[model samples]
Target chain A: MKQSVYDLTQQHRSIRQFKDEPLSKETVQKLVEAGQMASTSSYVQAYSIIGVTDPDIKQALKEVSGQQHVVDNGYLFVYVIDYYRHSLINNETKGNMETSFESAEGLLVGTIDVALAAQNVALTAEDMGLGIVYLGSLRNDVERVGEILGLPEHVFPLFGMAVGVPSDDEQGSPKQRLPFEHVFHENQYNSDKTQQLEQIKQYDKEIQDYYQKRTNGKRSESWSEQIRKMMSKKTRPDILENLNVKGFMKK
Target chain B: MKQSVYDLTQQHRSIRQFKDEPLSKETVQKLVEAGQMASTSSYVQAYSIIGVTDPDIKQALKEVSGQQHVVDNGYLFVYVIDYYRHSLINNETKGNMETSFESAEGLLVGTIDVALAAQNVALTAEDMGLGIVYLGSLRNDVERVGEILGLPEHVFPLFGMAVGVPSDDEQGSPKQRLPFEHVFHENQYNSDKTQQLEQIKQYDKEIQDYYQKRTNGKRSESWSEQIRKMMSKKTRPDILENLNVKGFMKK
Candidate 1:
């Protein structure tokens, strides 16, 4: 309790590597329960946490995520946008199944609720001095990961988290962010192109300096260039079809 | 700092009623900055927060959210799934805005990022003795809100939040959740409907009891019945069309 929640949030950093340590079932259960305490949309609780403990599953998930942290961390939990349980509740009580839990509204509610719960789990783990990194790379081949995890329709795996003791005391430093004015808008959006570009340029300079110093001058790309490089690629080209077939989002 | 993050998370309750005291711009900015500290997918940081302060806009948003808290609270913020800023970077650097920033994967990343940031803000506010209530009803009329917020393409208003000093000290106790085993699965999903049904029945009974007591015999719906009642109605039926016309979730 030495650090306030605000301080822990501000000083947060992602951990890609970790030391070899095993988390007990009870310990993991405590973290997962902490997730359940989060706010849910309409109390639907449209989410699930799969604690991957089997060695085979961990190795497969590591390959799926393209991050060794998945296999090396003290614990790895996959957060899934779940409607199956709710569907079950409907089936039992109403006896009238929903034709689609795949509406855009459902997508927002389910995805947001899952994300909120996952953040709770992450913050709690961080409070315990555990290093945590979100494994969004788990979506590199989402269908494959879903199949391996036995995820049914309407239970898409959103992301994974790797939690463990830090291999080194160096979490480095908190990354720099854009200017406060540029990010937090007042009332209507400030879509003034010139003003935003001017602010982004200044923030880009800060990012460039941070990267140049942190990476020992090996990488000196500005924020704009970084965004360009990142966005140029076609990621998960079949995303719509996957979401449609997996019953994620509909009208 | 006496309370652990776990305690703070578990004690979380929706704050609908708030004191008339106004929040300083600096305090809200600090909370927003703490949001930026959360992990982003591939550094996309695909989220934008609109601080609603204009009186007209506030009144309009309060109606849109169907929650008076939006208008009476100390602060109101709408978290938008944003890639327009990223599109701007593409325009500045690559001069060729990639067409793929509107994919389902992108939507997931953006939505999750916004939710994570929002939960940080909520937790920070709660830790500081401020009340917080997420405004999911903002989506009740997505187009109207988008117009009100002057939101551009690639920025969908996912949700809003109200934060202020608690009007009353009685925050109430946390709600009960499903058994640990029902929500937290092992390496693979347990699709055993019989076992799940048994557990859910017990949970439904507990919820029925809680609601009955809280409402003084006015309401006694079990968890299953509650979810049924919620899902029976088609909410935001035009959500897909809304998102499509507003330029979101394209391949």
Candidate 2:
């Protein structure tokens, strides 16, 4: 099922249900190889992939992630924003640690690095005829996830990805996204929502239909309704606290 | 010029200097089209590309970013971590503003959204035979960049990408990064730097060679040496202050 990366990218669907089949070591290596080739921030390479092959750990990660696919998948990896390794090098050479790696810039750049590498992994996994589901829910219990992985300071877990062969459980088509014009704009940001309002109303209907079909009418809500429900209250409040405890920011 | 996205990704080298030709409007539109198809976090679509096409705005951005390619390049876009649009939609739907848009998780996820979309643009631009250089230096004056772009409270300029045809200025080989083992540890983070020190030392030699050849020996420094020099001093100290002022985090 080798295909153009763009084609695979276009065809991407998060596989929450994965087959029992396990990927070979060689295949996983290929994915990591693609990940390693991703561009890093100034070659700081401030991201690390902690592959969790241990079943007990996977089960625990699944518990915290609120996603059962994490344990059932052929492979799982916790992507972390890492500055620990670089700090060691800083210690060795400069004799004193702490630099850009301890600032807000570090968190921003490191998160970008992790995402870039994970997108590479996702795209390459799709190319290799595999399925992936990114687990942002891992942040539901960020502190325990860190304890489980023994992640040290200056290393914050950002997200998780579970990859494996597809199962029949994950049926249906790719999810609908906002139309191009709404999300993207020319030259300057036309922050005026007036232009995109009607289009989004239409998209809400499409999403409502998608949710209807996806959940067998168990949940059929418009996109905005969903947003209203989600954003009506605070989302994960502990994330920044976790990051701060991990030393991602300096006062 | 058209190649597999993976091939192009592996061959990606940020072009600091670009030819003095401007990209056509249609070409850039296609790039953005590709960008819009990138994966978003929970369909929040929390990012916006602020294109700076006006020569004056581009000049100001270039001055603040300290990257000439931004002004010289055929196309320039400052990828912003945006929740302002969502806030508008929330305002319309939920009648009030604050939601995930102003949380720590929001910042993390929005940053991922921007990078994923930007990487798609980079790859598509490469497919179109153009070169791109990401301008993290834009963070050097994050607040100023935000003010220059007229960014709203919930929108922040994360990074910039300058795209155009390749110039003869960057004639050297690609930059050297840490080898596969150093980057892609398997099943666990081999955080034991003691195990990887010798390998990184070997990699330092390779980086030294790369910098020497690229800079014509005006600078020949090892990877650790460079990391030490860079890490020895703080960079972008204003980033957190700017993010705080921009309202990205809640207590």
Candidate 3:
């Protein structure tokens, strides 16, 4: 037995590189079932998944995902947080009744439902001895991705997953995270000032050291440096506008 | 050893009723680590979790969660989708940057990051041989929940997880989902018009059957009836407006 879910969970990490082996249709069906088994909002199941296997389509997605392996290596799935189904039903019954602030709650539920389903897919892939990487970068160009996938209004791609066998070129290393004291509060939310700073500083050093080791002492940057670089920049795939276009009011 | 991740995944079902058994601190720590191991956006890790063990606090949360059993059962975790830490760093650096929608992309990444981390927490909890339920009803009163959690700006509670040894109050049955063809698309998104109605009809029967088995024939409703009840209604969560008051323009 795995003893604890932690054992399976502690094993989670993003795999960017992958082996060329392909996932069978049977395995893919299993993956989809795992996702469906995940908890849904009020059992509404407010999400849908699109699996891409065609080489040409996968290549197009690979470009969108910044050439991530799962798109090219084995199985690629785009998880869409959707309200379209509800909207269809609402139109039939209420004649365009807006959901007000509670409707915003529906958006969150959809997002959460997609997240839960995606997690199950990722973990189940791991359990099947497959390497997987989530392509958050897919949000970099949602319109193109939506067009490519033929996603209709009220359906937005939350993220993509590339899953396959791990290749020799792939080296899986656990990423450093901010400490427990910082991330996990007690009954109440606590910001342990000193502990947080000290732990972060230590974690920064560890990340820098890890990078140097991985790169044979070629590249190195502190966690703060990385954050500064990443935050001080901007990216594309205007998500808010897309959500609005998809019928969500950020208002 | 597990034969396939799919085999293990099929065992997943949200368990709300618990056995009144408590979890150890070490176990909780391990579960949190599993969550931490989940991928973060640009490695920002823009989320925090609060483990509620105090009976009083859990009781208040139980009410927020529509009196869900898991909320008061054993361990309750409020996953806060946060940007406060980023805001703090921005202020410290005099960066004058906001985690809000400078572009639509920012909002998507932040919210998606939060969702992904929370999903990891739920899965890990289940893997631990413990039962867990996601409390989407927490949105019923986000501000009150925030007040209870003492959440600062940019640290909003997204959803909650209640985990522990499951009790026999009610055994959960796998609810029927729209058939895979209805949800999963191939290379191009296919709206299978002909198959949709038949599949839904089958699903309505499946859901009705599931309710009959789970509730001992007490109550039943078709898919459309449930949708009419849930989707064709008006709901609002004022706490969401507070996001703007706190300086997050989700727009």
Candidate 4:
């Protein structure tokens, strides 16, 4: 019997190094079909998928992402929050749909739509024996990515995915997640600071142990420590301005 | 042989009515575990899931959503973008993590994390022979939802999901999506105005036919018409303000 999706999800790890074998056209089409079937908020499929096959375009994107895998993967897909189609409809009908698609709620709806579709693509590709990694680094230069992809207004490049067969050197296991009790609330949120702090402390110890073992004691960092190091300085401070330039979150 | 995730996704349809059986604790735990395994941005598991079982709380949320399924489903999950734990870490370390979590980029990252995890749960439940519908209606009253769920600062309710076994009367078929060529661009986005408008015109007809066939010719609305009607006015004008109130996008 095939393993369940739950089991499949449990085995997920970001695959950065991949074999050179490119996915077949059929596989790419199947993955896109799977993505399209995901639930859209009010049937407003406010997203698009860009399949980059041209090496020059891949090179351009790689520069923006600063990741070799962006160019080395069997297939690269950049998912964008797209309202340009809706804008077309609005123009033809002389409608006022901008009141919704330009609002902050519009941003939330579009972002959720894109992520749901991308996850479907990710899981489906994994089931097909493909490894994948998300490229949020594409946001390193949102304007440059948009220019590279020829994205129009009301279409924002949210992230990219590099998918292919994992290489022999690509050995990775699922990272530990926050304990179920820490992330799951029953009925209402438990905002008790002491309880939360205790949970974090316990989680911190577990993460530190995991890192020490993984690196044979060469590295040991708590989750909080890693988070502090990463988040202490703002990353992509220009995101709000970029969203405005892309005709999103204007309201 | 078990169905592949690709095949499973093609069969997706938002299920509203459901049988009266609640999911077992084991199943819920399994689903949550699957959700947790989804890839997070830089290990920032910036989300929390609230399982609503109390009848009063369910009713309160139902009022905010204005959806009967909120109270009638076997399970109700409210997915929140959570940075509270990180804030706790920041407080203890006196770190400057707020510079990241309060920025627009942080909003994007947290929203992506929550949706990816939620989609995993949705697919896992469907694989287990359950029905699920996303409740973006939860955003209809964000403040009211926070009050009902007792959510704190650095935590914002993005959406909800209602899950259960499908009722005998429930018969939802997968709706037609935009043409693959329209949503999936090759190499780069095809921003040619004539081509895009033509594609939308074709999709509008297909959607019209779908609704006519599904509703026995009683209702036939084009995709653009429905979008215009639903989006001509803003849905949630206060979303930006609410996000700010919850300590997001302050930058």
RMSD of each: 1.6, 2.6, 2.5, 0.7
Residue pairs clashing in model 4 are none
Which docking category, incorrect, acceptable, medium or high, applies to candidate 3?
Answer: medium
TM-scores of the candidates in the order shown: 0.96, 0.92, 0.92, 0.99
lDDT of each: 0.83, 0.78, 0.73, 0.95
Candidate 4 C-alpha lDDT tens digits along A143-248: 9999999999999999999999999999868999999999999999999999999999999999999999999999999998899999999999999999999999
Comparing 2 with 3 on lDDT, the higher-scoring candidate is: 2
**Residue-wise lDDT of candidate 2 within B1-251, one digit each (tens)?**
33444566677778878888888978777777667767777777788787778988888888887777888888898899877767767767655546477778888989998988887787767767788888888988988887777777788888899999999876755566677777665555666877767777889898888888778999988878777777667788788778878878754
Q: What value does DockQ give for candidate 3?
A: 0.57
Tens-digit lDDT string for candidate 1 (B1-251): 36888888888888888889989978998899888888888777888889988889999998887878889988998999878888887766665445567777778888999999998888888888888888999998989999999988777888899989988754577777777788888999887878878878899889999988988989989888877778877777877787777666755
Tens-place lDDT per residue, model 1, A1-251, is: 37778899988889877888877777797789889988898888888899988999999998887777889889999999888877777776664435436688888888999999999998889988888899988888888888899988788888999998888854587777666677788898878888877888898898998999999999888887777777788777766777777786754
Cα deviation of B238 in candidate 1 (Å)? 1.9
Top model by DockQ, which number?
Answer: 4
Which interface RMSD values do the candidates have, in the order shown?
1.7, 2.7, 2.7, 0.6
Docking class of 2: medium
Output DockQ, candidate 4: 0.92
Instruction: Chain A only: give the TM-score of model 4.
Output: 0.99
For candidate 2, the lDDT comes to 0.78
Regions more than 4 Å wrong, model 4? none
Task: For candidate 4, write residues B1-251 as lDDT tens digits.
Answer: 88999989999999999899998999889999999999899999999999999999999999998999999998999999999999999999898899999899999999999999999999999999999999999999999999999999999999999999999999778888898888999999999999998888888899888888889999999998999899999899999999999999998
